[model samples]
Target: MSAEAYSKAYIARCHKTLKEWGAPLDGWFVFNVYDCLEEANELFTCELCGCTQVRIVHVMHNHHYFERISVGCICAGIMEGDILAAKERERLVKNRAKRRKNFLKKTWEETRYGVSLLWYRGKRLRIFRLGNGRFKVCYNNTSTECHKGKPITDFLTAVHAAFDLIDPVVEIWHA
Candidate 1:
């Protein structure tokens, strides 16, 4: 189906769902957006529009409603009444995924002591393996001991986390 037709159908479904749930149709805000690539092989059904295979999930909440809904980008746009902003948000998510892929593909130099290192944005990026089977990422002289509740279990995950840490600085540098 064409984009317009798909969007119209999704919007219609969204409206119907919202009305059924007694939720406001146009005042929902996206609270979070995430890529479900880890579950890519599994089918994801949008709660509002019933669309399947939605890779990027947008969690939306309405001020007047207590329950939140998870939907695809189109349904999110329809609920929020701003397709352009939803598209823009999805674009940034895609770019972040690309950057993470590129980060893993970068030629990281390995030290004789088994440390992985790379130079990014004039800062020395380093990944060190801890004795407890965890990983630590270092930028310049500062090192991150942990990444919130997520444990860095391997070199690749550490590198990805490093990208998450450094990409913000990269954006600031560009700005």
Candidate 2:
């Protein structure tokens, strides 16, 4: 289906789900699938407030076919999530970013010192030290250099913590 047409259908589905779930206007519907991905629908509860109240819902279009069916991040829904106090959410986001930075810094240190290693940007043990007690890190298509000194054993934990920041900010400002 065309992106716009699929988007409209997704919106309709979101409204239906909102009604069925007894969600208020303050709540938002998150459609977890692309119109083309014929899969069982799964519902996600807001991790922030745990209120099932959607402040903003976003319908992402994942147009891949060969991949083991992935749920489009709220594809059939309005930008909906929990109602977070603006300042509070922002603070949380900042904290999450801080955690991510720290995590990356530690990852660099570990990889550099040969104490531990991990893969990022398609390369295992990838890091560059700047000689000023700092390390450069790369992942996906993004790169950052960090100064904090820590040993990283769980980069995914840092990423998940960072998502806690990102999701709320998007709900507050973009959605």
Candidate 3:
């Protein structure tokens, strides 16, 4: 269906269930969206249909009425302008999280804090602390003969920065 048709149907449903702020659908907007696996602690009920355990919750607001409501995807599908965009965003979030978790479990776990060579995947990571107190880092190499380009000082910060190249949100810890 066209956007206008969805908007019209959404407004009609709002008229029955949703409270309009200033001029009904004029100022209605979706603020946030979340795709739950099992279920989030917050048991959100659809303001439009009064359904429970909504898999996807669309946090919406009516600027005219100055009211906020959380509704399920079924209700949001009729009102939300682009459900595809929301789904795309959800996919990206999951992908990033999965990459980060795997990097931590595999790469981070395999990292061996050696006296001279910090090894991961049986290859020495191109990270070395120099005598001048600056740590040298090399980017994209297969062997020990790597470039000394990025310089870092702190150990934890350097570790975080190195893995951030793979996944920015990847966590670093001492233990």
Candidate 4:
């Protein structure tokens, strides 16, 4: 559907849902938003509009009714009375996903000592295999096990950890 049509439909559906719940249409606040690509095999449906195939979910709360609802980006904007903010948040999420994918696809040069090296954001990222058949990632002069001290079982995971380490703001959504 076109953006205009979708917005109109979302606004109607959201208004109906809120009215039925005895809630105000414009008082909803977006508390949290996240991409559910890694959590579920099937896409989520918007709670307000019943729209299917929603990947990025927005959690909204209404202070008056003390109700929370999960909806898609457009519906979220309608509920919150700020479509631009919703679109901007979605844009950031998409950009983060793209950056993470590109970070994994980057080629890491292997050193003679078996350390894999890649330069990111003017900093050196290194991944090396440990004697215990696990991996460790080094970035910004710091080296540690990935996944919050858990043993990294593969090179790909170590590389992902390096990306997360370098870009702390990007949430890791495993493909």
The backbone clash count of each candidate, in order, is 0, 12, 3, 0
lDDT by residue for model 1 (33-152), tens: 777773264546889867777877888888899889998888888888887877777777767777777777888899998788899768789898889999999886666756645888
Q: Judged by lDDT relative to the true structure, which candidate is superior, 1 or 2?
A: 1
**Window of ten residues with lowest summed lDDT in model 1:** 166-175
Better of 3 and 4 by lDDT: 4
Clashing pairs in 4: none
**Compared with the true structure, what per-residue lDDT tens digits does model 2 show for residues 16-51?**
654554444233333232212111233334332232
Candidate of highest TM-score: 1
TM-score for every candidate vs. truth? 0.83, 0.25, 0.43, 0.79
TM-score of candidate 2 on Cα atoms, chains taken together: 0.25
Of 1 and 2, the candidate ahead on TM-score is: 1
Top-lDDT candidate index: 4
lDDT for model 1 comes to 0.76
